[model samples]
Target chain A: MGLQQPSFSLTALAAVGLATAMLCAASTPAEAVPSFARQTGLACEACHTVFPELTPFGRRFKLNAFTLTTKQEISDINERKQGTLSLADLPPLALMFEASSTWQGKRVPDSNPSAPAGSQAQNGTVEFPQQLSLFYGGKIADHFGALFQVTYSQPSDHFTIDNSDIRYADQSQSGDFLYGLTLNNNPTVQDVWNSTPAWGLPSMTPPVGLAPAASPLIGKLGAQVAGAGVYGMYKDVFYLEGTVYHAALTGKTTPIDSTSGSHLDNYMPYWRAAYERQWGRHSAELGTYGTHAHFNQGGLNPENGLVMGADTFTDVAVDGQYQYIGENHIATAQASWTHENQTWQGLLNAGGTSNSKDNLNQYKVTGSYYYNRTYGGNVTYTRLSGSTDALLYPVGTSANGSPNSQWETFEVDYLPFLNTKVLLQYTLYQKFNGGSNAYDGVTNRKASDNNLVMLGLWTNF
Target chain B: MKKVFLAAVGLATVLAHAASAATESPPKLAREVCSKCHGPEGISQSPLFPRLAGQQAEYLDQQLHQFRDRSRGDPHAQAYMWGVAGPLTDAQIKSISEYYASRKPVHGAAPSDPALAAKGKEIFFNGLEARNVPACAGCHGEQAEGQGAIPRLAGQHADYLYRQLRDFRSELRENETMHANVQSMTDDDAAALTEYLASQ
Candidate 1:
């Protein structure tokens, strides 16, 4: 696909307002109702490069968690817990509240008494969660089952209702056609991997930060999958899902990044899709997704007082996962390309220079062993190369050069209980790029690397 | 056909139990050995052992079972419990489950900082950059909901919360990130935060 200019795209969108509304739901953060990222005893990494994808395990997880069983571990909640009931009592509503607290290296609170007893990592700092969510899962009719979740976060106490889907799921049905779809927002097969999205991974910066930056652009809590799309099963083995929607509204229409000025929103149209096949314990999946920025004439001005117009950005990726279950070993590999040659492409405004579609290619390979069961470990290496397109300026500089940078991560996950897990991870970063496009005043000269250690506990009811 | 089916059902139930049952060692001598301190079914009726009954199975597995030789080192939990915790291999320790898993979690002490939880809520959802504190949700969970190995901090006993925070700061409770996360908080913050969490 080819990229376009900014000002021109906006005029076209202005001419077609209602048409745009149907394509784009209001531009705020889309909150898919929060569902357990993993259903059953299935873990996140099983489906996604990280979590929440439909790897065989992930897909099976959904079937098992939501459809297969309604026998939840007994608790005090008064809501309906059964998955099967007569049509009169078919649709059910459920709710769960979860919270967390963690400590990291040198960041441990002054009050942590265990600080001394723990390894050096615990001597650091900690993080936690403040969240509330409501879930609604039931058979809307005979063949259709509904899955919807709404989550509320702290601070502004923003409430998001997203991650809603309606599926004509019949595991018994075989052939080239199976079933899944979204009435509002939807996630393609690719978004299953949290690390794949803009704010979800690599970086949260819009058009500008498309390159590299000093701070982490990745957020652990995943972004919601919304918009409109559908997914299905083929012969009970192959799987496919696709979605088209408006990306989360950056808020500031004036095309600037999260930190550019008062922090405006970024709006763009996008589509994503993926395909997968399961051959016994071994399986593979392939997917691609991209976004197009449409300049909204009625949008706000850029932080710098520039009349921010519409912009476009798109990313395509092919990933494969293979698992050796008998011995409990899993391996994965993926390559992604983000083409920024589109109108909204490039890091900061390319300083008004001749433009080339910004091209970024990145991938990772990881393998882990069960090491019996309670003790398991994995090692992975990832390299992300950003575009030198004029649009990617300021924040996108890699430490090694102006083109490529890399991060190596190693993690150990121990599941002591069927419901609980502990993950210890170490990440090494390498940035190798430098250039002044539109944002950063200085370009990096020497390659730099930082090491981070993360230890976390995750559980569910 | 019905008789055969019933027989098969009986067989299946037995088989399922055998498959999932934790590797049994010295069968939990609930009264003879455990009751000396932990009370029956590990409820700790004495208020000292901190009732273990009805606890999330995962939480119990982690505290008494995960750590090896260092298992009994926790200062907050009773020392005798630690001694018991030390010899537990994964399956052996699992033999001793809590009564709480099947029971409801009851409140311990009354709230002191009546508004503390509300204040803590402020910090939990939002970061306290002014106090150099990050938001609690960044790790624990949204709405105080605990995840897979992380304990459900919300709705826990305030006294237990205070003791845990104190133990973490003192290096008595050597869990994962909490050891470090707690290191930054002041005792007051921990207590206030605990009250906040408990109230939630």
Candidate 2:
């Protein structure tokens, strides 16, 4: 089953009626409550500039372990009431549903050229209800909390676990030092900022037929690994974290692919460092993160010597973010770049990849502005490029042999209720699979033909 | 391609104008909408109105929502905030709270009786076991800057605090926990406590 794509867009419109929104609750949760607001007894404004876009307080809330509570509690009395403990008092449970429609610039030709008469996708398709989700989000104990989500995608007709980040964190101050620990399941999922690949924009998007074909390895390890790390914020200025991740069984009971092995040969190391400062109305952050991983060439079969060997991949990323918050307006800018080095020795031995080594790169930047917290808009541009290997991508023309792609996204959002949002988004493609025109070569499909428009309603009770 | 870029730029310009027109500073909103009763910069001219300056933003936001939802039904709340909060959008509520939180606070007038003020300080820092009243500083900070969702109690108007304590004890205010805590306190106790907090 395919996972629900995090469709990142601006906030929704507010003037829409609740009854009308509920009737149109044909969509899934974008910024659902999931007990965080209720547990903290604060509104969304406390944590987000807009939904999923964190404010300074929101970042602190995450780093402090999501343990702040307003419910009745029983404290654990050690020598000095050491760590506060409260009941899972409030049911940390919530549900979300969504309905959506996609309008493409041109009709999608048949997937199989041999069967041109076969059914083809039209220019516009309406999903009665696109997605549904259940969330268990909030504090698990005094120093531990988790945001666990399970989603059901209507188009894929399947259920799967979605984005989840469980953390064990606690802070202690030694004059200028404040430090904490986090044990999580995903690489960038524990991050407080949206500039990270895992939680970054398009908070929600179509699960199929919309994204680019290639991405850095940093974007590929969400549900397939577990990690633990320690972080510290020095005088609330410099931040650092170092973690190691190991492969976890993915795809439920699906058999492991013997050729393109999905299991890891050894632990992957990830690290992040950043400097942040906030002065009055403005805040800015500049940071870098990187990871090194080695995966088995073939399936991790105990008896197979060839399968025991490994292929290595190393990924490095740098990112920055800035925000200016005012009573009447909020403005933000974010950018990130990722580069991946792939050594395909193991894969080539297993007869998987075409080359021994390949390099890939991804770059993205977005700017957003919100007026009166009621109306807002954003623009994003992204580019992806990689080393050329004909055997690796022999599907199309000479341009398609190169892994170069680019996309542009524009969105506007309106919020009538702080907790409710309506959005209209448009996306454009400059290049797809290395070609701006005749991308697929055989079907005569152009990258521009894939332009899409979407309207969505997102809310939580 | 050029046309699309130009069109996007045009849309952005229009949207930016809309943003500039739609937005207003929180301080401006506070002065125009809240200052009539709470006083300029949240220092109240009337004892009946609570001092709002330097109050916790979280507390103000919560109270505003409560008032809007009619969960806070004190006589004054019903008479004043019910109407004020009814028409406020969430952003307005946040702006108003943040504005007040950032405002400079002014101390209320000292009580005429020093002995009463001293007694109030005792109650403020130390709980009275005989009455099951917890120390005010246990939850509110020593100087009452507030933490998390708790409200700041320092340097507030004595009359307003006294009235609230009395209201809580008399069931005129609807806070279940606060009412229970104040139930056994006498009028003198309420008076002394308010004076002590105001002195801070």
Candidate 3:
């Protein structure tokens, strides 16, 4: 009775709020958005807080292999009614586009000598249709499904495979346990929740200057790695997973390229553990994940003669997320901390480092609130600090001998339609490269001068 | 910065007006027109009328469109929903479905026979495989808290469930898979199962 009391109260509150809104006729009309809604016949609210931020039900849908669908299907049946070749009659596809304009607080000093005078620096710049993306997501077979994404960057003028996660899953008799295997091209690409770096807050942002240079290596190692893992849930409460990753060379037919970053000394191993609880309108999750990798740094300098040493790194992270979904409002908060330990054996052997060990730590926290899923805002604070080494980190350029910096971002979003969003984001820098003033010693650039504001439009079909 | 602030305020005002216009449209139509048998919030007092509260919006909307087009030809649907859904515009149907989906479901009383309910629970969890019946939990959720377009069966009306299951078995309902699934189920089984589901 005690366990059920809160749920009843939550339902009552939601009913009151919904009834009031119904009487007031505050909801907008419905329109088709994407492949998921088209195939499942469910509205976006069943799965998303906004766009990619998932609700509890969304997490379940992904964990179940995304095979649940109401679309027309073709299949060959066996004795037990097993599907021989199950496929959707319609191919699930969607197109997405984004446009943005960026404004920096101060003009950046021309750092490139090849740049022309007029092309040097500006306070504002706009990219019409900054990015165009294609997505093929939904059930692929009876027990298999995938979410694949490809993007074309306007600045680069190139198309590349971005993120892909394919899965095969099954459930137990009583439906209390679910198990699955995943094959993904990125480290956290297969993650179902938004608390991780793969799908966290600020889902979209500009690749502007003054962004932090030193991010934890865990999130950076993706895109060039091929990873495989197995995961399972116990009664939908406890989850566990382990994966191994290998360097995968892209744009080449060969398995390894010595000149590319896709060269690995050994396979990296990653592990995850989480516990989730959902009751009433409140849901929470606490989890830990980590990865260990060793890279051969000899190929970094082919002219120096191939050295036999390697740089080893171990990154450990912990994260938490909490969400409250009322009838008219939704609130979410997420936090994560990562600590990376690196041993510069190859760099030390090459006379590039004075120390053998270095450590980098990063922390991020964000909170968001939405009203009627139409208008919302969020704030985020992020900090990065690491051991100082003058030899390892130069005193000039973007970094200043120390990997220490802090920044905060505030963003407001408006959704005129369910598939369209307009957002404004402002960033403030408190510290950069261990100094608040004259962080870039060469140009005497202050940390506060790097502040930026961006306006963005995102839409999907 | 000031320009940005002013633009935000102006956009907000326009959006507010747009939202107000929507309120005057479908929600008013839903409340004023469709609240006769289905209550304002979609909780029906009569057992003959199926409770629409907490049903999936997608499922509800699909059914309304089907009824208007004569695609769903079940006796009850033909007798009741045919007339009700005939004149509903697409916008009105969507709004009514959304309004009903947002309402809270009401749990009914327990079965008069607890032993029969226990047997029904067994059938719900572990289907009578010898009779070729699949577990209801496989499609509906563990607690019958449906997903996607599936309608929630927990706390549904016993009379409605019994009639639907019987109709499915007799080919009176047009669902082929459901007909196959319930063909092996007996009248006693359907009665017990409905009682158990209604009490959930």
Candidate 3 structure quality by residue, lDDT tens digits, A300-363? 4556534547777898999999988765688999999999898877767765555789888999
Query: Against the hidden reference, what TM-scores do the models get?
Result: 0.46, 0.65, 0.67
* Residue ranges of candidate 3 with Cα displaced over 4 Å: A1-33, A78-80, A115-119, A303-308, A398-400, B1-200
How would the candidate models be sorted by lDDT, starting from the highest?
3, 2, 1
DockQ of each: 0.01, 0.02, 0.02
- Name model 2 segments beyond 4 Å from true: A1-34, A74-85, A111-119, A173-176, A253-261, A297-309, A350-352, A397-399, B1-200
Candidate 3 versus the native: TM-score?
Answer: 0.67
Candidate lDDT scores, in order, read 0.42, 0.68, 0.70
Question: Distance (Å) between predicted and true CA of A79, model 1?
Answer: 29
Model 1: per-residue Cα lDDT over B61-130, one tens digit each: 6766544455536542332343344444567556654433544554445566678867777777885676
The candidate maximizing TM-score is: 3
Worst 10 residues of 2 chain A by lDDT: A5-14
Q: For residue A235, give model 3's deviation from the true position in Å.
A: 1.6
Weakest ten-residue segment in model 3 chain A by summed lDDT = A1-10
Clash tally for model 2: 25
Q: How do all the candidates rank in terms of TM-score, highest first? A: 3, 2, 1
